[model samples]
Target: MSSSRTARWILAAVAAAGAYAPAWAAELPDRTPGLWETRALIDGRYRVVRRCFKQGERSAFIDAVGVGACSASAQKTIFGGWMMQADCRTPKALLSGKLLVSGDFGAELQGRVVTSVTPAAGGPVVKRTAMTFSSRRLGECATTPRG
Candidate 1:
């Protein structure tokens, strides 16, 4: 898959894991709202991305997780964290994966996800990839986008 597509898949998995939080915890963990930098290890390569979190957007992250064209199940809390299995279908491929996240979500957060993607056609081959990521708050957002 292309680099952009891979990044999106990893982000989606992370978001889904965050979504799994509500099923196990009554309230969402507090996170610093501002510029956050995330570094992900995909296929042995490191990629860093940044996102600006506006006020109230943090809460939306909880509700937005796993709310798209995906189905998630087998959610459980483990060792002060959350885990779940999920499957997502796109026009080009079907992705099934397991997501695990650990942290208080206040200042630091970490997660790991493994997914297998099967193409709609081409061949019967399935590609498997694993991604590990961590995010740290970087003070206030540099530029807040208009909503």
Candidate 2:
């Protein structure tokens, strides 16, 4: 796949991992609001994405994951981690996957997602992605002047 396409898939997988958490467990363990750096590896290529979170943004983050396009099943909490299977429909494709996430939600987190993609008019292709992510308390977000 092209770099941009691959990056999109990686991001979708990451978002889906977070999106599948049960509503009752909406608050992530060890989670802190701040700047986070996430590194994702797909087929040996790596990319990094950064995000800044304000207070109570974690729920928003999870809610933003694929929004109405995705649904999760078979969710379970395991020792030191959580696991789920999800399916999502993108504008051009359908993605289904198994996701596993572990580690402290505060300082660091790691996840593995294995996905199978079916284009609107083609055969299915599978992809595996791994993500390692961490966050640091960046004090506070800079206030924006009201326009």
TM-score top scorer: 1
Give the clash count for each candidate. Answer: 0, 1
* lDDT of candidate 1 over 12-131, digit per residue (tens): 446323433334345445466777777888888888877766654543333433446466566767888777776666667766778787885656789888877778564564678888
* Residue-level lDDT for 54 in candidate 2: 57
Per-residue alpha-carbon lDDT of candidate 2 for residues 51-130, written as tens digits (9 for 90 to 100): 66655444343343456776766677887788767676766776676767887666567777666767746675744444
Give the per-residue Cα lDDT of candidate 2 at 10: 55
Give per-residue lDDT, candidate 2, residue 69: 72
Candidate 1 positional error at 78, Å: 0.1
The residue pairs that clash in candidate 1, if any, are none
Q: Where does candidate 2 have its weakest 10-residue lDDT segment?
A: 129-138
- Local distance difference test scores for all models: 0.65, 0.59
| Candidate 2 off by > 4 Å | 1-3, 12-17, 20-30, 58-66, 121-123, 126-142, 145-147
In model 1, the Cα lDDT at residue 36 comes to 74
Superposition TM-score, candidate 2 onto the true structure: 0.70
